[model samples]
Target: MSERPGLDIKLPNGRHIQYRGIRYHGSPQHIFWFEFLPTLLDHTIREELKKTAELAKSTSVSVEQSVAEVVALLNNLVQRAYIRAVDVDRSLMGDGFTKGEARDVAHNVEGYNKYIVEQSNVYVLEYSSNEEKVNYAIVQEDVLDIKPNFCGIGININALWRKIKGKFLP
Candidate 1:
């Protein structure tokens, strides 16, 4: 007998089939950039990065490293808050999901992160899913203007905040 654990009745050839296994790849994840937060809301992120850097015990911590850790925390926080605010099952994203069937269940920093929504100020978010622990990201943080051009457009922060709050909360 083979090491496999399922019933091996090979008598039925075509109509019936058996799935040996299903692999959940934690590395080299498929990333999707759904949307981005404009520089308007990035003030808090800058302060957060400084705080992250200050908390590091090692003096050799670089800005890139600090930004990565904080961005991961923000995304995780948003996802969790949303899940708690409304039951994931109630949300239309997925009507319902079983343990293994839920594809977006990821909080491990060591896991490959695919859905990256970075605060434009930090502009650097990195993830290492496997043994290859290397930072190979090139972001254009230093532009000639040193600020994002909103294309001469104006915004009301108060109204924006209300819309954002309503979308995420309730």
Candidate 2:
């Protein structure tokens, strides 16, 4: 058997597709700008960078080294958050989907995303299936409005409490 698990596709719009393996769903830069940046802003990330710069100035550590460290940290955080978003997208779609099935879902999601962005700056709502309209998506400026399915598919929530409750609650 080949080491490759499934097919890889790079779309014209810069989105990537991996059938069974890992594929980043949306634009990571968008997630960084729309989701991560706002949370990181005026937070420990800034304070840590300032502290590192000051420490580099007083000590023998070069400014370049400090900058590189900060960059690496931010990159790690961004990647993890992006992956989490992709997982949520997958869960919303359904379970035990093949590579081809995932590709179809991704393609549909991308189409809706492009269509919505072209029309306006607000969020785009999408149904998972054309027939039943059971599952849906709500995306704005590329950031998905993820929440518990109990809220009804495609509906937006002010806070993703249940969606993210596991991360905080013991």
Task: Name the candidate that leads on TM-score.
Answer: 2
For model 2, the stretches where C-alpha displacement exceeds 4 angstroms are: 1-37, 41-44, 92-170
Cα lDDT tens digits for candidate 2, 42-129: 2434555556656655675554445456655654554554456555545544544632122223443344334323322111112112
The digit string of per-residue lDDT tens for model 1 on 47-153 reads: 56556645542454554566567777766655554344234323323334533233333343222123233332334332222221233332232222222338776
Clashing pairs in 2: none
Clash numbers, per candidate: 0, 0
Write down the lDDT of every candidate, Cα atoms only. 0.39, 0.44
Off by over 4 Å in 1: 1-47, 55-58, 87-120, 123-170
Window of ten residues with lowest summed lDDT in model 1? 28-37
